[model samples]
Target chain A: MAPKYVLHYWPSIPGRGEYIRLAFEATGTAYTESNEPKTLLKHVMSCSKVGHPPHFAPPVLEIQLEAARSTKSRKTETSEDVKSSSPFFLSQTPAILAYLAPHLGLDGVKKGKNEEDPEVDQIRRAQVNQITLTILDLNSEVHDSHHPVASSAYYEEQVPEAKKRAEDLRKVRLPKFLKLFEETIASNEDEDHLYGSSLTTADLALFQLIDGIQFAFPKRAAALEKSGKYAKVFALKQAVAKLPKIKAYLESERRLPYSDGIFRHYPELDGED
Target chain B: MAPKYVLHYWPSIPGRGEYIRLAFEATGTAYTESNEPKTLLKHVMSCSKVGHPPHFAPPVLEIQLEAARSTKSRKTETSEDVKSSSPFFLSQTPAILAYLAPHLGLDGVKKGKNEEDPEVDQIRRAQVNQITLTILDLNSEVHDSHHPVASSAYYEEQVPEAKKRAEDLRKVRLPKFLKLFEETIASNEDEDHLYGSSLTTADLALFQLIDGIQFAFPKRAAALEKSGKYAKVFALKQAVAKLPKIKAYLESERRLPYSDGIFRHYPELDGED
Candidate 1:
């Protein structure tokens, strides 16, 4: 049996976790989410030094495979402050994705066709990398929609700036992103996925991106999705949704609806076409 | 001799290519740079359809090892038009770092003493990811220094707003980032590297990041660097610089300096204490 995968994400908002969820769905993988109510409400004492960052942000897909007790612990766990020592238990989103991609077959896309086809993998990997970066850029845009100035500042404080950012996102960023995805799909005519015909992490990401955008900007997304250019993306999303295990999971309580996730809808941060 | 690698980068900038060059130097990899001005300029068109977009601007790394030619003959290439249909390429700076870290023996820090410990990899990988994301945030700040409004806008046009953004970046973002690196180093008390006391991609990135920051924000960086908190980061930069191959490479013309790269110097954007 494969390892029992555990996803650590803030319970309320989908934010980055949706990508992981969609990826698992696309692969028909069974995993549990560790999104307890206290996870968010409780204070997170960030790592001071010794260990890795304690669960670097949410949406971390923690691999539950037991190590062989792991190297006998060079860094001693005994310290007056846990913060001072005990080595970080875990953190870093890309590292998690890199570790999981190979296990989940999404990484195989990076490899070339033959046993020696590591070259082939580069194209796929690059595609995934590019999309992921784009996703982050989109994320920044999305973030600016609510917090146009300081991210740490409240929406109420920056509501006016947020309105401008939101308007810009709706008018410029959203369409630009959708068009880029549409172009990517159109460019990859024969291949069923972003890099190649078979599905990969890039596709899962695209699905999540579209889903998030649609949720956050329903009016704008409706207009963009109606343009008929997103048929392939729509098809990809439908395919992921229709996956037997994924569909079952979505239907079940496991699949949370979009609310406070990365792509949150403040309504006013959104507008109609 | 292993295959001579082909490095495809925009010849104009040292952005992402600098990281790759640092890795290659560390590994003693002999590779030819395909910094053809025409090729770099031409590839920009096809870059749009290449699937992913960086959250903003960037330098992408292309793996130059030869693969099967005639990617153009294949319909897959047709989906995404290319000025030159290269068989395989990798993009997004962090992903490229992840790919190269293993090949360059930078993974030794993560691989652990036994060489079989996966947790070591996970822990180190996590740190590298954490540092990379922080670097991206830092770069975004650097970009905002020049164009606070949007990337689509001209830099000169946004100089007034850029000054305010740069002020915020210098006072808040720069100190915060420097402090983070400083704290990580001070807390670890380990020699050199951020993860497990051995050189890794994190170290290379830290070196470049500090170098870029110092070059771009001379006044602020001078203050931050003089504040004495980033001692380890400074030490890491020196350690990496001392590596024979790296030193030779940096001295040689192959290592380009920053001008129009992702990290730029616009003295007007900054503020005095």
Candidate 2:
């Protein structure tokens, strides 16, 4: 029997947890999410007691590989903290993706083909991971668009500064990042995927990035799409959305909408197209 | 022969490039740094032409591994771009660290011992990487203290808002992060390093973080250190500085001081101890 996979994150918004959710959805992996903020906070605070490293933020994936282990490991009984007997626990969205990629058979490395050269495959995966991190950087910038002055402060309080940052983001940063991703997709001779023929986590992450951007800045994203400068990125997003599992997930209730997550759509921050 | 590592970053300050330099120096790996901004800009602009992924920012490490390959890989002859025949060109500081770690033998995995179990060792490394990223998060927050409104804007322009952000950072965020690091160090049985008994990149990163904090917020950091709350984090800093290679690097001219990088010292931002 497969061990339970529990994802702990804020219940309010998709946030970073969505990336993990997308992977599980795309791969058809059965998992449960403990989304309550208080629940996540409790678990994070008590992480030390469970022998896991303390994470600064939420979106922690508590993996239960109990079946693989010959003996059961003792877990601290905490009423507040979300308890798990999982031998392995992971945090950091990109790191979580990398750890889960091999387990879900989505590492973008094939067995007997071009993946024959282990060194080449490792380098390729590193490149994919690099792309993923760059996308994450863009995501952080997007979040700052709404909360330019300070994250703790309300968007209403930071609206004045957010306008300036959003203008720069919409005019300069957005196009710059999109063009970079555009070229990345164009680099491959075959218009197959980000890392060649097979779909990798980068592709999934890129898809989510586009989705978030479109949700957060509809007018700007629409204009960029219409301009056709970043055709490859939009096309890649569409392709991922069309994936059977992904398509179903999108139509399902499991896929949450963008609200107060990293990519928030504060009307004032989203400048005119 | 080992490949020549050429680090590309802004010559003025010890930015993200410093992380890679610490790793190379700690491992005694031969490497050179290209300080010219024009060279880095050109390579970034022409990254696609050279059949490599485009990077938005600098701290690009171009490894010259031509000797290992039988054939020369043609590169676009750009007047401004830093040319390299090395197939691997990595951007993003953490990704660069991960890529270089295995080659330099500083990956923090002990062989024929506790590291005999590959699964356990990989998890441990993941944990180390997580801590490194958390330190990076702290680094970004420190950078934001000065440029809270917009990264492209000058500190003088954002003074009013920066004051508020810095106040929160110094009074709230700093203590939270330092305590997290302190607890992380306390979790380990041996007081040797951040990752259990072995020295990992996280230790080097934490050492750098503490150094940056001290440079950027002297009064605040001194106050925090004097409080004896983060004793473990300060102890780890001392442990890392005592490393023979690291000690030599610190005393040498190669070790650049903090300037306009992520961590900058602004008396106003520093606040009262």
Candidate 3:
């Protein structure tokens, strides 16, 4: 049997963990999420295995190797296989996505007979990561729009600062980032994809980012969408949404609703553009 | 001749470019900075070459291949070599560092005869990236401490919001991140490095992050340092500082001073712990 992919993250609110989920969903990869609060707390708070380092926070991806299968079929398995099959746990959303990209065929690199250029493949991977990181940076800024004063504090506590931040985000930062993404997509040879001809994880991330922004600031997002200034970005989002696996995943219950997470819908915060 | 590494960023402030510089300095790698404002603006604002995507911002790393040498030594080089040697430009600080890590021998992966395990090396690289991204996240938060309201606005405009953010940073986020780093260092087999036995780019990043925090919040950083709670983190900083290349780089004219960059010494923001 193949190795198991287990995701450890918060149970609710499609937070940073959503980026990892999109990668899995888009590729039709099988994975289990350990969202049980108590169990996840134990797994997240402690380094249960020897080789695994302590993760600062979750959306931790644990790749359980042969040991996971051997434990079920213990009588038939050899001790050597189990001994060598220690699980690998990796944290941080971008790191996790990058690790999974090539495996899921979402890295936009041609393989097999067509894989003539290793240099191009390497550059493509870097470009994918670059776009993903920039999208996440914008996501972080969106989160800060609500919790400007402190992440630890409630949004209500910093309403004034939140207004200021949301205003700047909608007015200045959002336009700047959106324009960049728009130009990036427009510049690419393939109109649908962010980097190469095929879909990459960067496109998936951008899809989720734009989706979240729309959810958080409906009026502003709608106005921008209607204006058609970022038609390429919106088109990419639509293209990603139209992917069979992604479409099914988004429609299913597995796709958690955005709530008190990074992208929250606060009426007052969603001011005029 | 080796390909030249040219960095494009703002000339005055260390900013995000500093992280890229530290990687080069720590490894004693030969690189040039295209800090001339006009030249840098052109390189940064436009995708001057084909195959290179437009960078959203700078601290762009341009690897001028055979053409850089051929331009000067046209009499010695073949047309084919120059034609194939297009410059590769990569942006995003963490992305740039990750790309440079393996080349600089700061990726914490063993090579040659001793490199028996490809899996371990891959895992080490992921761990190094995970740590580096986390430290950069903290660095971003440090930047937010003073510019809580908006990155575009002046600090004076958001002084009140800055105080709230800084207080939370000093009281909550700093301790949380510092403790995590402390525990990470303690958990590792090697006392000096974050992963494995040798230096990695993550350690260099952490050293810069801590140094910037000290610059931004002297009283708070001093108190924390004096308390010795994160002895290992500070010790790692000292260890990185004492590295001959890093030592020379720090004392040399190349090490730009902190001013209005991510970290700034706003006296009011550095409140009591």
Best by DockQ: 3
User: In model 2, what are the clashing residue pairs, if there are any?
Assistant: A11-A35
lDDT by candidate, in order shown: 0.62, 0.77, 0.84
C-alpha DockQ for predicted model 1: 0.26
Q: Is candidate 1 or 2 superior in TM-score?
A: 2
Measured with DockQ on alpha carbons, how good is candidate 2? 0.43
lDDT of 1 by residue, B188-219 (tens): 54766666566777677778878888788888
Off by over 4 Å in 2: A1-4, A36-38, A71-86, A114-116, B1-4, B64-66, B69-86, B114-116
True contacts kept of 1: 0.22
Per-residue lDDT tens digits for candidate 2, residues B163-210, read 878888888888888888887777766667766677777888888988
Candidate 1 global TM-score? 0.80
User: Which clashing pairs does model 3 show?
Assistant: none
Alpha-carbon lDDT of model 2: 0.77
Candidate number with the higher lDDT (1 or 2)? 2
Cα lDDT tens digits for candidate 1, A74-96: 25432243224222333455556
For all the predictions, what are the DockQ values? 0.26, 0.43, 0.44
Candidate 3 TM-score versus the reference: 0.92
